[model samples]
Target chain A: MRTAIIGAGQAGRRTAELLRGLDAEREILLLGEETEPPYDRPPLSKEVLLGEERPRGLMQRAAEVYEAQRIALRLGEKVTRIDLGAARLETAAGECIAYDSLVIATGARARGLRIPGADDPRVLTLRSIADARALRARLRTGLRLVVAGAGLIGLEVAAAAIQLGCAVTVLEMGERAMARCVPEAVSARIEAWHRAAGVVLEFGCPLTAIRPQPDAIHLVTGKGEVSADLLLVAVGAIPNMELALDAGIAVDDGILTDADGRTSHPHVFAAGEVARIWQRGAGRHVRFETWQVAQHQPVAVANALCGEQKPYAELPWHWTDQYGRNVQILGTHSAALEWLEREDGGRLIYFGVDPEERVHSAVLIDNGREATPLRRIIAAEKPIQRNRLLDPSVALRQLC
Target chain B: MAWHDVAPEGEFEMDVPKVVQVGEDRVAVFRLADGFYAISDVCTHEYALLSDGFCEEGKIECPLHQACFDIRSGKALDEPAEVDLAIYPTRIDGGVVQFQL
Candidate 1:
């Protein structure tokens, strides 16, 4: 059988690797729109922005490894159309590639600002290595950076810019920063930390207009006008589901798929940020823009393609490093769960427990050691006592 | 290879890993259900200390990205970590745990 995976990001690369691993004789073709090989994305906003030199060995696997595995990598090739009836894909260069199985791992693109003057070439967003390098080149001592959104990417860039001696200001439309993912208390603490680190954060103020100049970019928000040397609109990301949608595949915000990444078509599958996977726990389709999902979810899809059906049920997790502090979150955070907190040493850990005293989610600040044990504890689905959770003497592994 | 004293055996708790700086390399000494095993303290994928990771079932999981490694062989057993860690031979000398460099 032949498998063709489009958009060779983490998800696509992993799916191709796993499929090749399962069946060595299978013909796998991995197509990436970018010229570069599949490289890690988490470091693009963190270490790449903070360090002076680009880190070495950024590729997930060397070309020799791919060659040894017989995974044909077609870089800089864009799949223009997917003809489901013909079981083939049309590339921009007028090449028709036949496939027995098709996997759409197109991922996502950085959402652009919609306000007037937003189309200026100077307005930046960080999504790819090129974007990171461009943004890093502009970060100099005494430079003014105005970030539009206070989400994870925006705050990470703000932290990096502030540490790079740039006067940074973050504007968020929501009342609390990272309100969509983290709890209010966590966002408040992060906001306070950013303020202490010389970052000016403005919440509940949406950017109304932007005017680009030779020297600076003028931004007008609901609060007032601010001029900066650079402007970054880190609003969010939009899934690249156009090909799947044009092919008549079911899609909402992203390409719809089952737990095993099976789409409406029998021969077609989807994964990564472009897939709205049907999560059993959520009781609805959910699309995650997390590195964990991109790296791990493809295993299930690959297995399902090989005739072994295993559902992807891994817990959602994401972490961010800012100003030497590490913040890790596991599972979802919502007001419906009761929040509890405890401090051990300088690390603060928060647990979101349901009314039945079951740990649903957790947020750890500088508490890396407890991550796995707490994950097991939450996965065990056993009721835990609040006192034991708050007590420092009790080991988390024992509770698991 | 020369043996170097890492820590006293009394200082180690069961199923816990202790990191010690030996020469220019950091080694993580684990006291598992069987005995003691030593491996490089750093994760192969990122800049995280594997000593801060969770050790269970003869395997250690990186705290940062959850990349798992076999403690016995220092083999990377999961995603995000493709390189295997360096494993060092360990022996109990007198009342201390010693690992070879």
Candidate 2:
């Protein structure tokens, strides 16, 4: 059995490692576009950007792990085309590798800035190691920074910059920051946290243009003109589904996959941010762009390969460390849900309850303790009364 | 030290685990279909209280990351958690639960 995994990321590397253990005789090839080993992407905007940790610290496994596993790792190589009919992959180096099974974990790329002056040297995006290195070089104390988005990446960078004594300003087109991922009250708490840490947030403002000056960047917004030493664009990411679409695989907002990560084509599987997985409980399809989802999805894919049909269903959880704060989110909450807050010391627990009074999702800021019970409550669909949830005097265990 | 004075013979439910703090030790007391058992309330993976976790069958699921542990032996079920929780001796005495610290 020959297996070829595209994009040497967390999902792809995990799949190759599992396959090697399952069938040692089976040939496995892991192709990575990056020259380095597979590394964690979360720290790029935090530790790496702040220069607190080196870029090499992000590597998921040591070099010996790949060598000992007897997995073929192709670095600095790009897969140009996937011949689904021929069961082969064409590489940029002019190598055709035949495979019995192919896994597409191509992942997603940072959405590039399209406005004028986006090509300037001061304009940056934090997605890969190279981007982090470049951003770190320019991140000096007392420098002014203009961040174009208030999403996770942007907020993380802003927080790091503020800690470094940089005057940071964040511009968000939405009325509230992280509007897509978090509820309004939760966003308000985060907004207040950032503001207290010396971050200037300008909401409901869109940048019209970016003009590069000799010493600063002049950003024209609907509110007013702002000058900064650097500009960071972190609006969002676009799924890399071109190869899947060109290969005749069904593509919606992302490459459509069943519960087991099986694509429309046999012997072809898709995982990570590029695949739109079917959420069994929700009875709908969703695309998750987080490290936790990426780590858990490969298990279903590997199980499917071994002839075991297992549905992929894990409550989505993500964590972010910014400005000495640990923020964790679990499950998904709608706009109609009510918010309940419990504050203990520096920690804040925000619970979102549905119309049936069931805990739908939760957000924890500096509170790993509260996150424990909240995770299970969300998973069990436990109905937590709003008043009781907001009361800090009552133990969370008693509520359960 | 009498069995009848510790706890009611069948007051504990199979589904909900009761939390009991004996001296300085926090214990989670559960009554399964087979018998009653007691384990430390703290999760081996994190500082989570095991009594707050959901109880199903004979296993207590850690609420933090959903790591399951056997109530009888107090052994961790899977990855992300590789340590076993502490088990305590328990008995029923006069309609009350008496756990040996």
Candidate 3:
């Protein structure tokens, strides 16, 4: 059997490797739009932005490993069409490839600013390796940077820029940072931390216009105009679901997938940021753009393709490191959860408890050591005592 | 190889690793449900102390990036950590824990 994976990002590479591990005799083809080999993206906003690590160091694995596994690695190949009936894909170069099974892991791209002067080369977005390299070159000491969003990417870049001795200003449309994913209490805490670290944060401010000059870039927001040497639009990402949509596969913001990562088409499957998988806990299809999900969902997809029913239903966890502080969030944020905050020494941890007294989610600020035990407690899905959980003296593992 | 006395049996906690400095090297001694085992303190994937990781079922998950390693064999079992860690032989003698490097 021949299995073909499109978009050789983390998801595609993982699917190929996992499928090869499951069936050694199966033929696999991994195609990527970029000429470079698959690499990790988490460090692009941190280590690569600070110039602490080289680009080659971000490679997912050695180039020789793909060849050694007998997996065909095709680079610079963009799939333009997918013929589901024929079980074939057509690349942009007009090359047609047939496969018994196909995976659509096209991923997503950075959303662009929709204002005047937005088309200027000075207005940048961080998405690909080239974007990181270009931003790294401009992150000089004493340079002024104005970021147009206060989301995770924007705040992370602001932190890195501040460490590089750059004057940073972050503007957000929402009242707080990461309003879509993070709770208001956690957002306020992170905002205070960033403000204390020499970052100027402007809430309720959205970019309305932009004026690029030879020396500096002028960004006009709801509050006023700010002049900076560099301007970065870190608003959000748009899923690349056109290929799947054109193939008549189901799509709603992203390619819709069942619990097994199987799409509407029997022979076609999807994973990563481009696919929204069915989440049992949420009772709906949810899309997660996290490093952990990108590395994990492929395992279920490969297993499903090999006639195994390993559902891709896992608790979503996301961690962000900024200004040398590590913050980890476990489980999905929801209104049904009542949050309770606990302080251990100097660290802060927030637990989201449902009406049934079950632990739904948690937020840990620099207390990653408790993640494992807390995860076990959440997975048990049983009623928990509030006082014991709030008490710092009681070990979290004991609750499990 | 030389055996270096690190700590007493009472100092080791179940499923917790203790870091002991042995002549310019930091070794992590883990007390599993079975017995004591020693491995290099540093993570193979990044600059982190494995002693600070979460230990369960004879496996250690790095606190930094969540890379998992077998505490007994020091074999890396997860991604982002492709290389295995160095392990050392350990023995309990007269209430003291010692490891051979």
The numbered model that scores best in lDDT is 1
Per-residue lDDT of candidate 1, residues A1-400 (tens digit): 8999998899998898889888989899999999878877888888889873556325456677788889999999999999999999999999999999999999999999889999887789999988998999989999999998999999999999999999999999989888877888899999999999999999999999998888888899999999998898999999999999999999999999999999999889997889999999889999999988788889888998898887888888999888778899999878898889888887878999998899989999988778988889989889999999999888898899
Q: For residues A84-199, what per-residue lDDT tens digits would candidate 3 score against the true structure?
A: 88889998999999999999988999999889999888889998888998999989889999998998999999999998999999999989887766778989988988899899
What does candidate 1 score on TM? Answer: 0.97
Docking quality level of the chain pair in candidate 1: medium
Model 3 residue runs over 4 Å out of place are A55-59, B22-24
lDDT minimum window of 10 residues, candidate 1 chain A: A52-61
True contacts kept of each: 0.40, 0.00, 0.24
Between candidates 1 and 2, the TM-score winner = 1
Tell me how candidate 2 scores on lDDT.
0.81
lDDT of 2 by residue, B18-38 (tens): 776656667778888877788
Better lDDT candidate (2, 3): 3
What is the per-residue lDDT of model 2 for residues A282-375, given as tens digits with 9 covering 90 to 100?
8988888887667778888877877777778988888776766667788885777787778876667888888888988888876655665676
Candidate 1 regions exceeding 4 Å error are A52-59
Indicate which candidate wins on TM-score: 1
